[model samples]
Target: MRKLLGACSLDVFARVDPLELIAPAPQGAALALYVNLLAESLHAAGRTARAQANGNSYGETVGELALGLAFELGARQGDWDAFCTALAAEHARAPAFWRQAGGEALLRKKVNDMFAVLRDKVDADNYQVACGRPCSPNRLYAYRMLDTAYGEIARLFAGWREHTAQVGAILGRPVDFSVPIEVRQLQSVAACRPEWIMRWSESLERFGGAPGPLHTKSKRFESLKNSPDKIADMLREIAEYEAISSNRDSGWLHDQDTAGAWIEDYWRVLDESAHGATPGPDLILEARTEELDAPMVEVAQAAPVADDDPLDAVRAQAVSLPPGFLSAARATQDPGSWAGRMLEDDSLPVRLAVYLKLLGAEDDCYPDAWRDPSTGALPNMQQLAALDAVSLPTLRKRRDAAIARLEAAPRTGG
Candidate 1:
């Protein structure tokens, strides 16, 4: 009883530390919490501007790092929807912060911070591969996981429905009931409903499904499956897919020329990684070719430059020039306005990456920067909650502004 009291006291003590609220004791989710803990590290590095000028990309890169780690971890472990919603919320915010600092500062910060998360995430991915899950562990998200779990429950219900026929046939009685409650009334099956699984997961005390151990009186639903492995696999699957769903690397980025000047080595490095294997035989190559051949829509430009198309100029600027406000501005055919030049650039992804680079990946990257002295701390959930304090939806406003500015630019501005 003395030992039990001590352990309970220890848990309570751990909870009182605000830092532990994010990380938990002994690191249940170190990589995850560290993604946030980074602000503390960067705060240690000095002011955001100073840290950014060196290309720390601390905030943006940390998001990416967390994504890769979360993807792998979620794929291996637990409930996914809550995990992914948390990530989607994180990623959607950083690029705008990076963009405002200008590209040079953004690059410096990213270069500064990527080492730790990459190592751990890659390790997680390697483990996932070795484990031989039918899909990589890092591939699912919260909603999809819930969907899968729901499907499994439905199937189990169907099987139970079928099983009743066998039971009735043996017992010389009619079998009827959706979740086997009748059996529970006469026996000890408890008639646990699968719906309860999701209900339990959504509760706040459970951390959106990161509940304590399943084999407990409060979590009596575990009896429904009878096999511990079944629940373990389902829970682990939630974690895996959540990890994968948050990764930013999907899409046609493997395509050459689709990427801006900085990525000219796409083909070369891909070949090198494959030990000089011919590119023609690659499926990735074929898919890229197909995508590139699809109709290309030309985004209108803002101003005149020596090159009729400022897209090439932007490419040159990215490859040969250092990233900064003027470098990106000079790349544009037009130098008139900030976002206008981005729309004027021919490569859409580069234009977007540049925005993401500058803005720090969130829609509200430029929100009321004037408010407060600026901690440059990545906004906590509390700070972000304050973002809704602004009357207009940020994405709607930015999109309106970008399109308005792009359309208003003179054709010759290109």
Candidate 2:
């Protein structure tokens, strides 16, 4: 990430004020963290230019802003040109899709217009994660970012109550929970209760609905009795059909595979939050916080250590060991067993790098002494350097040299 953004630091971009559209109190740390994560992910994916283009912006990375704006503009899946054409066709020709009860239709239109921008800005997958439910284009206008459903269901219920007249229009009468199971589809995750569908049918006959399609009778409603979960799965399978929707439809407008998995694993993560997975091995070694400031090239100086350090004596002995021991360790360590080879290398630099690669450049060993206070995996780089009678930079170069040689050398008899 540093190499790519060598021209500018994230600190610069993060300081810029974001456009007024996003609310949520202009996140600082979370925004920066997300940006860094996104940058690292993109870079790993080999999109150097794109990753760097976002810089280190604090609030809302460019990708988030673009997706949200596109959504507001009614951008869907398709070739860019084709999608834009479809958005253009729908822009001004149609009336607002839904209207508020007491307020003028113009207010509804205004609300929808504002929402379009928000919709375009939100990442579809993230939107779902935040909401704990799916987002449909029809419902996008009503979504409020500050309200979370698990707790905000009250607000939603209140809104429905305030708009009771409109709610009444949809259901063909004023309604509440006691109104009956038929009016609102009682949600179940995996399966639809047939009894509920039967109850709904019975209610429809008595209550009636809006002018279109409701009065028509059909066996189609019978299939709904089977289960909502089954229905959901069917929807999931057909979810990809958004691509075939229109000239500008972006299929699902998010990574569906990821979102779906996330929803499924929500419970698992909750359950395992306390402990499902085993703890990772105590590496006893990790790069220090100073790694970003520290050079890959070693320096000669280190903090002083006691003269009688056993490590000092061990290094002196390792160098004088019968050459046969080094070769024997080498013969057994192969590229396929690179980790093992690292374990076996006699060169202090090579061994240190093996530790670095195993742990990471941020390792605690190098900055302090060879002793890893964290895990004690190996002597700290400082201690090792002291023993080698070499500068840290000299040691690092030799280590890197050894690594290059090891990687470049031909495969040997196993």
Candidate 3:
């Protein structure tokens, strides 16, 4: 069945458009395209891995590539069973054609052509997601062209002695027998200059007998010809992402080991609290206040609340706030303090909500009166939202705004 599927020409299955491939089609051509693309990509990846001398086996490389492609397709289509069913249907078509000589290589070439078109569709969608901007397959193709140009230029720079005239043209200076400093310093894509790129593009026809991407008659990169700034920005973006991806790969093992390590700490803390091994919630260290250069002001303490306040009755019946909770909590605030002054316009519940977000509900600095009696911690967002007579989203927006204000405020002493 696998041989029969491999033997079938991809053109028969490639007639379906990319947009239709994401949805169920009666012809089941999408499944054939996906399967063939996966197979070809694995083969290509395995060959590249071996050439690079990366110490990875072809089986290991293909296995990893297959898993990655499966995840990408699954995320896009949300149905693997359909692909399987379509595979079975494809195996049963054109049995005579399946036995024809040279069908496998022809099928591989056709499959590559189909994905060459479809790859832009997938990458364009991903570009929008990553950048929050619209992009076209044509633009993706342009990026590839620019990347290729960079690679070629780097190759010329590496062998500056052999390609002295071309390297000099790219550098806008004459080259000598001695090793050039630029060649030694050109370590990564980020260091490749816009002028070097432009000069290389302009000089390619003279040395290589083929016009560079920007210099070609093709209008694909026409707008980028005179715009070195745009070219520089794109080159920087490529370099930045390459560095980030390299870092992620380097840290993969450490990340995997530490991923779930936090759960153990969480359980240990809960167990200690239940066994009464932890200190009382009120036994918190003194607040650390930075001394500003300016003179401090003395703010008056809030007046005590009467025992019969309506809020006290509501709290007692509902969430169990301690007596004089509001008054006690407010008395601790210094109106002259930076955070206090910034959040002064917000209601008490909103202020508490900000603390709940920035500091967790059980921060040691929170006074006992500020905590819910049952939970021995600050009230949750929902509870605080109810106290403020607002919806949870409104409370969240206000909380975020308040935090933003605090973040933007200038700091005094360290």
Candidate 4:
């Protein structure tokens, strides 16, 4: 009976635990409550032994770190108020004080300060590899939120006919319930495209007078736009995590032990040791590829550098370029003007990936002045994977596809 229960996904575990509200709240509230529920669910699944195995007394610290990161991420991305209000509306609860004017700044400061402590505690490298790359504590929080959102979407998909209005809302068009749900329409959420969420949010203005999660101003959902593949990947990762988490004998538990041992041997001695070892000639090596042997493709820039395309306006808003783009961004505060530029691109995911790369923070690369004051330069590949809520390889594929689109765009004024 216990073994049977363990097979259920975290979404299923939510049903067993009463703490999780039926309706959504702010991401922070929702995730914080869910993690507590997850900890308890671990016991029900008979895996508390592993959760409590380490005698470090860091009870639920991992869960706490995850929730903390979610709140900070919301603040950093300018998404806190919009999301909180939407959630409160969904749950029919009054918006929190923090959602009010003059409250957001206070909340932002608090969240930023909290992350200062939390980031130091988390071993980001270990967390990234284990949970999927680009894995910071904040990214982990985003993954769980997206996982939950996918589950919500899946639930709605199950009874498309019964809830035609909601289904129509999701489809971005009126639906005929008398007819069967289209194969492309009501398929599993894992198979569902991320654009559906964006459309649903866009379509909701007429129905609910509010945007859907994906359509909001938040960078939290930025990576998810038009990327069905990424959506599917995150859903699977959550499912896999739940499966391993519930089974004590699963290799994940063993990996945890291995990680803990590594910490004791290497991490602890790093500062004290005279010579700290680094990945070098012996441990790290570059791969040799046939491409290296191939002749390089040469392309000339014939377009006048002085003339900015109408599209540059959108690119300016969506990304932070090496050439100063701040002036254009500041000239227009209306995102709608530039948001449509994304539509001109073939793959929305690729466009969004490009934006993330150009706009996101960088480490040890660009001068601080060049980066976005609010969110730094683009993230590394591993971090990009986390932002997109996918594995490293998947992000690379999408990023490459986006680059191809850019390269293919015709240049004028030769």
Q: lDDT winner among the candidates?
A: 3
lDDT of 2 by residue, 1-414 (tens): 233222122222234322111223342433333233323332243333543256222232332232223222222222223322333343335432122243234333333344344343343433343334676543332222111211122222345655444434434456664543422442321123323223333344444452212124544333344454543443332333222222211246345444433332332232233344432323111212122222122234344433343333333232222222223222322332333333355554456544453344443324333324445444444334433444333344456555454444323311
Off by over 4 Å in 3: 1-110, 121-136, 249-259, 264-414
Candidate 4 residue-wise lDDT, 1-414, digit = tens: 112212222333336332233354564665444333432343343343432243222233232223223322322323334433443453354344344575444434433443443442243433443455566665566565665566656665666677678767766678784654543464444455565655555655665687766667888767776676776677666566555333412235435534433322332132123234343433221212111111111223222232143223222222223223433222322223222232244333333345444333333323343334456653334333333333333444556555444434322210
Pairs of residues at least 3 apart in sequence or in different chains that clash in candidate 3: none
Residue 141, candidate 3: C-alpha displacement in angstroms: 2.7
Ranking by TM-score: 3, 4, 2, 1
Please report, in order, the local distance difference test score of every candidate based on alpha carbons: 0.33, 0.34, 0.55, 0.41
Query: What are the TM-scores, per candidate, against the unseen true structure?
Result: 0.21, 0.22, 0.46, 0.30
User: Candidate 3, after superposition: displacement of residue 13 in Å?
Assistant: 8.6
What's the CA RMSD for each of the models? 21.4, 21.9, 19.1, 22.7
Give per-residue CA lDDT, model 1, range 308-411, as digits (tens).
43322332232222113223233432333334333553332333333432333333222222112234322332122112111111222333345444434323
True-structure lDDT of candidate 1: 0.33
Error of 3 at 120 (Å): 3.6
